[model samples]
Target: MSRGNRWARSLILLVILPHLCIEIYCSKPDPFAAKKKRMSEKVRQMFYHGYDNYMMHAFPHDELKPLTKTFTNSLSELGNLKLEHLSEKYNGSALTLIESLSSLAILGNHTEFEKGVLWLSENLTFDVDARVNLFECNIRVLGGLVSAHILATDSTNRLTKGTYKSQLLNLATELGERFLPAFNTPTGLPYAWINLKYGVMENETTETSTSGCGSLILEMGALSRLTGDPRFEFAALRALRKLWSMRSSLNLLGTILDVETGEWIEYSSGIGAGVDSFYEYVLKAHLLFGREEMWRMFQLAYIAVQKYFRYGTWYHDSDMRTGRATYWQLTSLQAFWPGLQVLVGDVTAANSSHREFYHVWQKFGLLPERYLLDHQMVHPTERYYPLRPELSESTFYLYQATKDPWYLEVGEAIVDSLNLHTRVEGGFASVRDVTTMELEDHQHSFFLSETCKYLFLLYDDSFLVNKNYVFTTEGHPLPILHSWHERLPEAYIPSNWTSIKGEEPKRASAMSMQICPASMHNCIHGNVQLESVCHIPDARDDHRCLSDEDCGVDSTSCRRRLCSMAGYCGQWRYH
Candidate 1:
């Protein structure tokens, strides 16, 4: 009796236990999978939110603050005296204008964008700065013109398409004509800089680095596409040949070079500021133009970056000749590396790098212009983060690729930190002290272009799902027309259009649409109040200014002030 009853019970228990295990574990989804999906959606939301706010409010409106006004007015005050070309003399102004215009175009701001284009038409010309340096001028005029042309013909804007086509084509011809003289060298590498009106320096050394040669693809290739001319593309391709020929045996490139002799000036390599974009452009040039050769070049360069320069935490520059590690500091420009990594299908690496970089931002409340690798300290002298979105940009791409929720959490944390620390009455400001988490009231143009654009895209990539959006070299999104019939020509279109094909559309044009939600404005409300004080040493006086007069004979006196003010002079003596 006992054997039969026990055997029946054991049989029942065995059958039930296996089914229970399957129900508890196998039948239920993996917890990690659920967590990853949630993280991915959050990342998407962060990008979309940031993108919408930027497109609606920030991009359409120029900084136009007192500080920016002062900067621009000072430049305008320089008049024609400051060398009208894109030389170092005018690089700052040209860069500023280019960033602004690029941001506007990305946001699809037709009215303001047309104004910017008209301003360029009236003020800038191939000949205005003809005597200016060649490469700088080329980047400014050729790059600027091609980028503007892309915006002008953007199918989304539809306000002034063909109006600029003739102008843009003529400008492309002029740039192509100007760049021809630089290609006369036997090595095919152009001089670092050229005069627009004149030819290359006969004795100019051909020792150009990757960037000097690599950056030409966007401008020249765009010009080729616009004008239906092959010469533009040929010139850029020649430069690529010269630079690629000089790659170190390791396939890495140095920082600087002689344009005529083809000798490297600085044989250091990394995916940082000076050298980062060279790698970026190789891949992008292929993406934009569908060039297999450029793609091959990118594959080689990217492999070198991954194998040699990349660390678990960051990318470091190495000696070009020895392949030995060199600098490991976080340069201001290195911020774009993660985003570029995401673009190249290296999402896991990109996510790791992004997390490390965001950790720096979390510690400082904003990323310093540069960070020391060993101590994880912000470079005291270079503490300004100019509203760049490289980390956020990477987060956007990672979310897009992996659909991870952690990236959304990262994006939200970034937005919260930015609002809490950087947002000012005028707009977002730069960093004052990375250690102290202080703010400096100077907003950069990329706040709209890359920063806000990435944020918005984090949330609403769906907006771009059907649209062919190609970003500028700086990461400003460019509209790719799906069909010629859907194209928006610049001429004869009003500020608002009723329909794309006379079907009585819902909105006038993409330019007039509001991308951001109203709640985002709440995020922008704050003043960059000076909440912390630090005393800077003054050698002029032995005694610190407790009541102002104690510091110096000529100091203005205050009878009684808070210790906070006295702390500025290290004079807080307790009675």
Candidate 2:
């Protein structure tokens, strides 16, 4: 062991050990990337399995019956409260094809999207004798068309651009014209049901859900922008404005109302099916159209929902007039609220609600249609899990906002659950009951349009890179383009995209470039400090805080709180 020998050994150790560490660091499996690619391909296969089967057995039909390997013209059946008045003579409008259009683009199947668009342009029609729910038709059909039309006309999509006329736009306008007659009511609120061929059906139910008349602005507004006809936008705006006027003093809206009388029919309200999309549309409309009115309505409505409806991230139904708790239960549709909250920069609260929904998803291996929170059990009869996309949709949004690997894991879990329980030889089937994992025959069009699409986008969002788009309730992607707006506000900034600030002024956020409410209090005022998913009463006697000095850092996140303009302490995020 001389000096020369010791020197040689030390050099060997230094060089070899450094190389080994580098190799280990580089080669250690990146589980996130690997899982993402694997799950993405799995989702693609799932989509083609359903899409190909629908083409084989259910093409030109409304929905596929996977168990029977057949089709059902289910357009009239959806949202029909009593499951009555289904027409025997009504043929399909190629419902499955129309729904799958945006999905094709999402999966990067340009050729297939082009082929489907061509087929739909040449063959599909809304001219059949079918009584359809206004909300269902607008979201699934009109939203689908407008979304696909934008993709078709975009040069980046590799679509057959030259040959494409505004064919989809033309069809959308015609369908929109038919929708106009439904708005001819005494109160400006459209009828819940309308006959495609003959307009509003005789003695059609005067009752409509808040969402029925309130969620039309996105589709109809896009139509006006594309076709240069204001009737569609004007009618939708009129209905929305009228519906806003009908809200209770507490800023709550009921689930159902009489279109003819402009009165509340069922005053109990919550962020569930009938009223969920109404809240979503207003916030998104402001983003899409740069309309301050929509933003004001949404800000007030959102604050009210958080104040009265939320209980430690679990929202329950309440009397719209009184703000009294009515139904202490959870519906799968309410899962969308977390995703909507993300758009308003309430990621902390969004994360809290999303985790609860994910926990429920884990419990059932799927999210049941309804869960009785009071009993901590699935609802007795509303036990079905209808391949809903809300959870995955929120998962994607959360991932976009946080870039956390955990959301990708959630996406993986969701993809696994679908493949294990719902995949059939023909197509994906709905869960008739979560308790038994029993399969239902009906394959909802949204299973393709939203569920699979969001799952795919979760794993691979190249389409969303450098682009700003707001997704409709049905998961249709509507780009927030400058050309589509009637008037672009100076303060407006597109979601997820960076804005340029210069001598020419433009809108910006208090915290970020995004123009959403920056403070948690501004977003929603109830429990100002959102540190955890569950509420734990602070030991202090007075919970109110007048300034940032009065508040402390969040216990869970260690993030600072600020005095919101509402004069309450609220959570703040720096990035």
Candidate 3:
């Protein structure tokens, strides 16, 4: 080679290499980044102003209405009780007892805190109701236990350390034991609902929607940690694995399935209510368990969701097999997507998605529960906002990630909307008409556990940042970890921390389980306790010397049944 040729090649390599390095190391301005930032700031400002409004105009200065009186009286009464039995009816009787305890704890109300403990200690029971369903049972009991555990451990909470430790441990054990029935299915996927008392239903259909099967991990997984029982976590993991295994070759899961056969009962999918928590559980399971496999599965599933479902402003499920778009529009449950995105380091996308949803909120003081796909019109009949904080939850995440004042502004806006439309004489109304901005009188427990909590976090975040708070599937904060005390520099507190009331001890008797029927046949039942039976005829002929018709008993049923019993029965012959 000649010297001049060598010099030219070197010059070319030098220029190209440097340019490549710059491209690799530096990210370009995401066209959506600026928009997200501006929108977030606007939201934060709105939240601040709204919070002021709530404090001044909306919040009850005195107990005037029945609901207000009930709430105030409940709090005051809860503070004075002496906790003793494991079954106190009033102080720790309702499913909302944990939230009540938490609220008081957050306020540093020692009287309420002590009463809550007394109530929980005396009333805690692990019995499931004959009519109670499985999912509700788990949420009330396991959710209560976990929330109470957080309060017991929190230094700020007035409850003494180990005050409810033994009872909590026992509660964890019992709750873990109760979850076994849900995993008794052939496919290892839980039934949509189960009866607590009668065990599982025999001859019962093995059908379940995504929400029914996909929302178990948080409570069960937490139980596993608290009780040192792997079975609870294992059951949740098996459900996850079973569901994942049923995904189409394109790596997409459908909306519903026959739990027994693992067949696609409903092909349509959306990032909404019935299916939203499946994605949430994947990421959160990994976070809690530190399992690499969970992370890998989440990465694959998340990438597929983003690649196939995402349009400019919304996400819809595509065909599980072909990756073709099936639905397009906003869902009330889609409000949580942005928060999930923020968790996975896609702050830019999270910001954009949140802004679009915020626009929906602005158009209506609160976002409607659902929207149309092609028209961008709100679903008229479904126009009530359930007072959910999913969008606000995402806004809080965006704010924490960017430190942009916009998130605070969004918070202020949400606070304003709630105060303006939802604040009744009661604590907060359950739902509101997006069109009329009229308040609905019902108030759900989550208003305090999730919605108000997020709003509080957006404004303050001191509580959240001070401890590593992991939110449950229901958007309830759990297992607050004080890791920051060791790792974070003294001068900088993560803006995500905002102090709210500590979670209160769950009343034992408040927990309820559903009662389902028992079957003799070899079918997987809904409730966890029933043993599986294989009633489907075997593919292999016991009577060997038969004609083709006798031998040709459909293999599909046999295969499906086999798979259903085992949870993950490998592949299926659908045709």
Candidate 4:
């Protein structure tokens, strides 16, 4: 009774099985979709909460004392440990508004972004009697203005349609001019501080961090490109070149140097506060401005960093001159390294380091300003969590690379913690003490510029579709244009070599440039396939090698090349 009917049913089921499978596999509802949408909105509200407060209480000031519902003209005080020479008459520059511009665009608040742009255009001025830290001003103010100007004028910026003049650009140019006076030092390296009103202050201190001397390239370079000035770019580049030249033979830069004498004053350095952005700019400068020079420098510098500073999943402060670990501590700022590593296609390494940071974040409920890695405790006095964005910034980049939901969870935790502990009746405040969860009155401009922006992008990245941008140290977005890029360096050839020959030459992969030997692993570099990463660099005559990597791989035998103390690579030795 059922044989023919069953056969017909089976045939029907078979016909539709493939169709059902396609829908189930391809069109299944995204599991994280609802959660991500919810998280994105939460971040949006966080941004608005802080921004609304700043507008109310700190509208014209550099930052908000959210706890006090007051304002602080913090620009001049940035990087000034002693907060010296802060002008009482320096009312404000609407600094928080400038910092929030790109964040507004990223969050799709065109109306607010446009309003802020117009207000800043009309009201902001740099001619105050205030003295400012040059590096801080360049990254936060100049970078912000230039980015907002680009966004305000871009064809896609629907909010500013037909109502825009190049007001922001003109403002940025004026600010860039002010910065030029600081670079007038004999070394072409800029003074760390400058008086916004009178240029460099009389007998201004000449000592500056490595970053102070080297991190200006991106913002200043973008200023030059947008304004056609070339002065800003040249000044920044000259300083960077002089800074690089001052690096030790290990290719590691020190913590502090004297701009006037072009001499290193503080020899200890690592990829943290005093020197982080310098390393960041070298890689990013190559991407943004198409300079092959920065890439070459980054390769050597990266190798040195990996060799000397990196140990397992953490990096400790090291003596740049000697390539020895000097300070075994984890800094909140160092959290940005994972993101940089991701950009370099070292995702595996990035992930490892990111998880370690997440572990520390879980331990403290916030990343302290410093944690003694060896002691496994917070630094005695450096235990404050200023609500920096570096951890979230790295999480966003790692999520972008892998599309892994775990990063979303990491972001969710960050959002929850920020809302739970930092949020106040007015706006988010800094943690003056992580141990007590005590809040500080001041809200940093970067809290708006980077923290919320990175968290928002982590959950919602539609703003990035079909666009390539390099975010400055201040988290301002600068588009990467084909017109701004130069061609990759030419391929390496062995045609003229007297010794060895092997497979066809390929374009040198910067990630493969190693100054020391390591366990080999793979990493990404565009569409170009690279050798197992951490390969020995090419052996060249007169090349001094401290380890086996400097000797490079044997071309014909593909054997390990050895280095002699005489700074030459020798052939493989038979056992």
Candidate 2 regions exceeding 4 Å error are 1-31, 81-83, 161-165, 487-575
Give the poorly placed runs of model 3, Cα more than 4 Å off: 1-93, 100-111, 126-130, 154-158, 201-205, 438-441, 480-575
- What are the per-residue Cα lDDT tens digits for candidate 1 across 134-198? 44445544565666676677666564643644575576577678778877776677765555555
Report the lDDT of model 4 for residue 255: 91
Candidate 4 lDDT (Cα, 0 to 1): 0.78
What lDDT tens digits, residue by residue, belong to model 4 across residues 1-575? Answer: 12211222222211101111112132556678899999999999999999999999888878999999999888888888998888888988888999999999999988888888888877888888989999999999999999998888888757576464489999999999988999998988999999988999888898999889889999988888876667788789778888988989888999988888998998988899989998899988987886767877787887777667776557888888777679999999999997887666545456767887889999989999999999999999998998899999999876765555778999999999999999999999999998889999988989999999999998888887767788999999999887766422223222453222343454554433421112122233356544332333343243445555344443223356666666555656521
Model 3 lDDT, residue 264, Cα: 85
What is the model-wide C-alpha lDDT for candidate 3?
Answer: 0.55
Error of 4 at 425 (Å): 0.4
The full ranking of all candidates by TM-score, starting with the best, is 4, 2, 3, 1
- Which runs of model 4 end up more than 4 angstroms from their true locations? 1-29, 486-575
lDDT per residue as tens, model 3, 1-575: 22211222222211101111112212445444555455435434433332333334322221112233342212212112342121222222244545444544443445645655666677665463332335545654467667666667666644755455456657667656755886787778887544443456556446777766767777877776666566776677667777887887767888878877888878778678667888887766655554445555676676667556765446766777877777666887798887776565444456667877988888777889887767888887888886787987887766654545566667778877777776655446646568876655445445555676666556544444334456775555565333211211222322433321232442211001111011011122343332111111222221221212111112114222223332322334321
lDDT of 2 at 93: 85
List of clashing residue pairs for candidate 4: none
- Candidate 1 lDDT for residue 435: 72
> Which residue segments of model 1 deviate by more than 4 Å?
1-68, 72-98, 105-108, 118-124, 130-141, 154-157, 161-165, 172-176, 179-186, 195-209, 416-429, 436-444, 477-575
